[model samples]
Target: MNKSNNKLNKIIDYIRKDNGINNAIEATEQASLLLILKYFYDNSFSNTIDKLPPFSKVFLKGYKSHQSRNGTGYLTLNNIFDERIKSNSSFRSFKKLEEFLALVPFRVHSIKIVEVILHILDEIQVDESLADDYDNLIVSMTNSSISSGAFHTPIALVSALVKVSKPNKMQRIYDPAMGTGRFFVESQKLVKDDFLHFRGNDLSAFACLIGSVNLLLNGICIDNINIEDSFLYEDNKKYDLIYSGVPFGKPSDISKYGHEYHDYKNSLEGMFLKHTMDKLALEGKAVLIVPDGLLSNMTNGFKDLRYQLLTHFNLHSILSLPSGILLPYTSVKVSVLFFDNSPPDEDVWYYDLALNKNINKRTPIKEDDFSEFISLFEKREVSERSYLVNKKSILNDRLFNLSIPLPTNEETIKFDKAQEIAQLNSENLKLFSSITNYFDVTSRDIKVENTDIRTIKSLGNLKTGNNLTKSELLGNGSFPVYGGNGIIGYYDKANRDENTIIIGKVGLYCGNIHFSEEPFWLTNNAISLEIQDTSRVFAPYLAHLLRGLDLNKLSTGAVQKFVSIKKLNDIEVSLPSYEKQVELSNYFNELEQAKSSLDKLLSSFNEGISLLNKNIILEKVIN
Candidate 1:
């Protein structure tokens, strides 16, 4: 992968160095064309010479026929005398009888770019899936260009959609906004029918050319590829399968296409929705990734569109997708809708794929991520993340809002109430028992306890933390920096080195206390407690005892909470034996661990309840 990426980078860098290339998008477009032409030409150099473009054939014959012993496949820029590439024609076209060819590199240092292209092809031939590596290269190279809004849909999403559609070789598949033709490419891997017809349309001429090459490489014919705005391009042919994830944003001059739509003006996605629906054959299935607003947007256009979907199409499934699926482009939340041009159904199965992880360019969505969703989809059974909803209940005033209910649970309401009652009662009994034991222990050692009742100042040294700014708390650091809330970030320097108890000195977390075992940098929001002598006191025991005190009541300031060092030092406390302190500290550690576990369990339980509510609440209306 590294070698393949390196070779791709070399080609893109060469394109970038060319004075004629204006932006990364143009570089990607040129690189894609060059890579494909080189791949086919290099495969059968002698036999394919006649198939090359006019000037390209002469250039390749001179470059390849040279019997160089030394392995430098560099060519001179002076040899590229092709005027057709610079002719006044669309980048993908040539007038009269001229054939198309990517413009040759113009920079002096781009002589060896052909070698890099050949290296990339070598890696790809070893594993054909590496063609996706080329796709990634194009996406990364073009990411900085303002004109580049087309992103190849993540392969995982394409695979999931294709599986759900259950495409057969006999069926005709179409993608209206086919960026690099990824949907068609991925579908070809699943559909085994040799006679499958693939068709696509896109607004970008470069995208159309790339999609054509990509489909050809993936063993799919590209006879039906159209380079026109799908919204305005009327087609009489019907398709058995249609899948698209249109660009999510406000489109330019959509009002021009208003006459073609039922509603005069709507979002780009809304227009595409109506377009695809009209193009579906009888009993044809279509899956689309649409913005979440489409389900509930109050505009008359969206309302009418949703009503049409339910009235004319069988809207079977709605899958709420996680955000960042199209990262570096748009973070808008989207959902997948699977509907057939058959009769409308009474119930719609909704799945909230609460993939809680964040996705980005660095971390992409993968095929395995859809495994569980596919399993649940096949079962068609309601689970924590899946539910069934009635069509009529969602049809409010003919608006047809299809937003699925967020997950929650009402069956556990009585259980929650009973647990709360039991928790409160247990706390009351434990408090009573603790106070009884405290009084009994102190009363017996009345004389001895009086000698040990010293101020906190004598028990330990309290030091205020050094102030650290946000900038200083980042980078490759060794020690964690602590603020009131604890471990705000990391820094290279340490102000203290000891097993110390951290006290929240100010703000909302003023009364909080935390323990640290390693060297750390500290901010002024907290103070550290370092005991002078451990034989007389245990650090953990003191921390637990201090935490039990009413420190919040002692806090000052009306605007923001604060605790002074003097107030903390002046507090008097009875001291237990060193042995008893150790015992109590160990017990406190166990108690803290147990509390942490219980907190996690409670969180998981709440999540389960939320998921349950999402499905069950809709049952009352859907059934």
Candidate 2:
């Protein structure tokens, strides 16, 4: 963490220590806002705290009264607070200033929060983006609602999206899901023209307040920062450049959108996609982060929405972000969809930024990580990480799944090397065929053998695993601890030692498959598998076979999806003889090895192709 981050965390910690504040989130938010307001006023009137906003003036009066040894100090503070709530709506939320008093405990400690604010203020200097200084605090501390689907957009991502859109002073901008207005502030910093106008809307009241303060302190007006459900709000306003990180997997309330919500409004992100398309001016451009499921979901509404996007807009680019970018919030993979309200294009570009970085809340992402992507993106050039696909190919795919496919291992092999290998293999095949032909090759007639079909329960035992809470995860234990989404952490002890298949039994990753060859601890969220007759069926082969089954489709659970053992047992599978199972397992293992080697080769080819492209571009440079 940097210096500013530590200071903000210190303030949050101090405010959270107050027992009087029943809602710690609300209290921290209010205090953070108040401290920021004071800093804003102090910057304007450095000599004294007077002439500040009416709200600040009232708070200062209470603080001053407590300092003096004259009257009932605490009572005097309550009187000022009561007066402010009656007069100001912003103060209404923080009705009991006593809670704040509790946070400060000692009247002398009043300056502690103020000092932190000032330190933050100093960092938000000429060149610093507001997000660069305060985004971490705003995101980490703000409350998250699953229904709202809103999460803090990383500052690095916000900045990159803003740059990608290339916001100008003359153009209008908007962020429908603008939490804390990070996008708005970043846009303001990039504006080179004289006139700049942007609109922001969010359903969360706390977000609106925090956003208002963030914009105000950044020297931007907050007149258009509306605190309303953007989906319900009616407006015909169009923008030249727009960007947003829409809530992922949230339900849409179509009741508010009226007839406009008739089609795909059943889907939350689909509704956001439609809304953005409708709000964009002719030839206008937009970049939004959407859940990857939206691209692949087979829902009628989602499919229609995908078609609508490709037909009505120039679906120019899709940037696939790897898992963990939104960690501590969601593990769902997301993509940045860049499109314009122009005629549909013949080809769309895609970039894969899934380059092996394990991003989490503790280990944050930096702008430099996106430098190569941004550089390649700005030039609209194809690299190992980027490619262009034909629109017709997308139209042919099921549900028009716009999810860009990264280069396969085979595709990554250079054309020359691949061709040479292909020729060699072709020659070898012909020679072998000639030898067999010369030897009078023949096929022996054999009867087809039938294998018995059996349910999972008939062949094995399935039971829920042990519970390994996030708090108990030591991370440095001797054995890997498996969860719904695979190894979450490590533990000191192993629960099971036999080779088995772990099936995600609960949550978003329900039905997901993970194979463990060594002893490991499995979370209760998943089901541990132990084949009763391993000689008849290889464990690895069964694991691979189970993986082919669409388990996610059978998942149950309203709030949290789950796949139960009963459901697994109901699905019948073919069981082969012991000798056949062994032979098949060996064959599968060889195929896996081949696939792994191909992946490595493809990865290398991708790197080589990218290098070649970059060199070609450099050679064309005038300098």
Candidate 3:
């Protein structure tokens, strides 16, 4: 086997090895090494991955074993780790992190390599808390790799603008969340080598490791790095360029370590926006990634944040991020936040990427789609791109320009009243035929992939919709009660939370499915499918490929909107082979297990935040 895979297996074996009853530190150390190496090598933070030899058999066995247990697929696994360090320079104190962040190779590679060694050290019971600090930092970063890769901003989009758009050299660059330092890496291509140094805050100590490695890989010196609690810690610093992807809504009390976070009465985005502005130079440029909800929220607080961002910064341009662009794991809508430290320009350039689309839960994400956004954003021929000018033009066009609409009187008005308006007038109407069509094809294309089973597949039990009481409907619980318009309300008591998923049987919501973790009550609005015998079939596995991406393209009935099992069973099934189907199903089942493991942590999300305050990692298995 190849060296990397061998190493990976060794790491896995170390994590959960069966060495005489209780697990030994050897396995934990190995798992630790795996985590660190994966984080640093990923994203070319270190330049040596492409050349690593194949990992060993024991390592390979462990690698496959962990993968089997984790249910992580090829793309997801591939995105998790890489050893491609490209540059590096040393720095002092806080700047060491920045310098490394700016030119991340040495630090990235070193961190990964050292983390593994440290895991070994931890296994040998090393006493270096400082090394442990760095190790923890790497672990923190590795855990979020799925999301880090998800939000990778291509240099193609931001490179040219950083050089030409902003007219100042020696700029200061900063990111609030700073996952793997995409903004810094992208900025390096556009801005002068020494034009700016990196400054950013992150709740994830692991992201700190990622940014640090990314900076080192880019050839930035570590001495320039400034690490701190961005919201609470004051460095009294200022800069000419600010780039960041501050997280979405406030992650309230989501930590167990009793760390305090920004208690924004408003959304988390607003707080980050203000935080970014607080660090901006008089004529600096700030590029942020914000949600559509922020731009369109009618709340006075949101308006104030916009107003503040506008008055302090030029509010230059708003670029809409393609849907499903952030995470295949999630479908949050996002937009580019471009503005300068000066007053508003005559008109903001709004470039909508036609190639960009919404988050398609139907498909798994890859480098291809997100990379497309970067390429599209980099194309500067704004006039050629579809950008809305006045509110009239925007309303008349019937599309949401991923770009920020020029903040004209009408444009601003439309934004503040965006979600409130109900009239679908020509001024506000959208043809949206293509969007509907896409969803149509996606929902219609069913991959019935388990039909040719040779084994005795039998129904375990078919449960009908429960007669949920009206009072139960009004109760204060979070179990999803599926009905018209999907999850209409909450059910106090749940009937089936684990192992069963609900499918809409009637109405416009027909055919839609919900994954439940508890005994959720289903109203007459949906149908629940439970597998009986799996010698021939495993229902959940079949349900996996069928749930969201399957079923009818059209709503059931105009009046009742109902779908029967007969109709569902009649929809084509695409079973590759009984064995393969079961294999694939088992893989998906493992994924559910891992997800279930993570979901249990949600209850302690607030507790995690507390830990963050004290500079700790929560809910993570430490090597």
Candidate 4:
């Protein structure tokens, strides 16, 4: 498996370096075309070309001729594939292949790159053993180039959703937004039967071609993989099972669906849910991955959608996935919605999967992580991590919110609070003592003549962040959005990583400095500071020094304060030796830690006092 993966990686690397390819998407598309051709060529009998299909024969003959010519051929393989496409008009796979090949920029340089790719593909004979490697390579390439709202569902999440759906034999399964047909591939594993039929639709021709190839590689062939917008495509056929991770934040013009869809025209997810509801056969089940905002957004469209889901369908389960599961593509916190077209149920099961660990490229979600969810999901059992919410409670609420309800237990809560208080109190005492030891570090006398003065420009670079409209912010997301003051909202994408220093750039909060410890989005109202030489000046010390310098006093403008980058760059500061700066930074960090502990200790006291008041009131009422 590793050997096959290495070869696949080589193909991707070669295409990525090729000058003909514009981006990863083009590289991935061209690579998929070559892979499909190679797959067919290797599967065909080289000893007997008479039994092979016309297209396969063309590919084999062309490849053999090219190889015979010492890999230096004036022959264009794309033209050979195009000729086969033109002759085989009835072959759906060939048409789809042509659609993908048409997008590739075939030039002399690209032909050389294709030769290298074919050589790598030739090293590994095509078989069922390469299926997993093919899927992984496609996913890796697709994700590496994912941007502009293009994303594929994680395999771990796909496997978990398939297991929960429990597809049956002979069921007509469908994925409306299937990227590379991952849902179908995962579903094939669970059903292990040839009776199942798979149908898929996608807007991207590249996705259609790659997905068709993926299905063929997995030993599952389907001719109904249509390349069109699933939303606008009119289909009366109902599916037995449907699963999708639809495109996020894309507006759908549902005017063609009639007046009833007017409310959902702006919300693509809402439209998709309604579409899924319409296309479900009697007793059909569906499991969709949607953003958290779809469930909790108080908009009328979202509320109406949730109301229909609760009153009409058997809304079985909602599994809240942890954030960062889609890192490097998006940071949207999402949840899985599992439902069936049966009569409405009185209760809905909710599971909150909190891994308590940072989910990044280094530590991605795994199949093992879903074992507990699957076990408890079968029986709809209520545990610490899983709970049930009554339909009446949801219906009676002013807004039909489907957010997961927290499991409440008084004794458990009290015990947890007591433990938290004790821990915080002990930590606060230790921090107070440690902070006092460094109290005099900042007050130490420094020889002014020995220090060197420098401008902020020499220390680092400062630039404004990307501009985002208020509507672009979500009610809840994985990354916090920072503006002039502090975090004003949340968003699904982050522009900066941890420990980044930000200064407010405009309005009332101009020149306000803040430090982030986690990945966050910086808006245009703030300026991000990137240190050029960390060895010369510590970042934390610089932040503290800037705060002490009172940057707000440097702001200009009559009605509103504005701190221009030019003014910030020209401001001079006296710098001590790197060692002294480190010492001062450490002292300030200790002080901040002590202050945080003190604040937490006070909050705990308030909680304890509130609990005591409640207990006294209860005692008096009982007496």
Best by lDDT: 4
Worst 10 residues of 3 by lDDT: 614-623
Please tell me which model should have the higher TM-score, number 1 or number 2: 1
lDDT of 1 by residue, 296-318 (tens): 66578887888888878999899
Residue 74 local lDDT, model 1 = 36
For candidate 3, write residues 415-517 as lDDT tens digits.
Answer: 2232323322221223244334334443533354535532212343435576665556764566767663356678666766466757776533467766565
The TM-score that candidate 1 achieves is 0.57
User: Which residues of candidate 2, in runs, are more than 4 Å off?
Assistant: 1-7, 20-24, 39-57, 60-133, 139-149, 192-195, 409-623
Model 4 agreement with the true structure over 48-152: per-residue lDDT tens digits: 534544444455556566557755433433555545334543455555555544543333245566566666766776656778888777667645543412536
Ordered from best to worst TM-score, the candidate numbers read: 4, 1, 2, 3
Instruction: Please say which candidate is ahead in lDDT: 2 or 4.
Output: 4
Q: Which ranges in model 3 have alpha carbons more than 4 Å from their true place?
A: 1-169, 189-196, 224-227, 253-266, 356-384, 388-623
Candidate 1, residue 130: the lDDT equals: 44
Error of 2 at 621 (Å): 31
**Which scores better on lDDT, 2 or 3?**
2
Ranking by lDDT: 4, 1, 2, 3
Q: Give the best candidate by TM-score.
A: 4
- Ten-residue stretch with the least lDDT total in model 1: 91-100
Give per-residue CA lDDT, model 2, range 318-340, as digits (tens). 99987877765677889999999
Ten contiguous residues with the weakest lDDT in model 2: 614-623
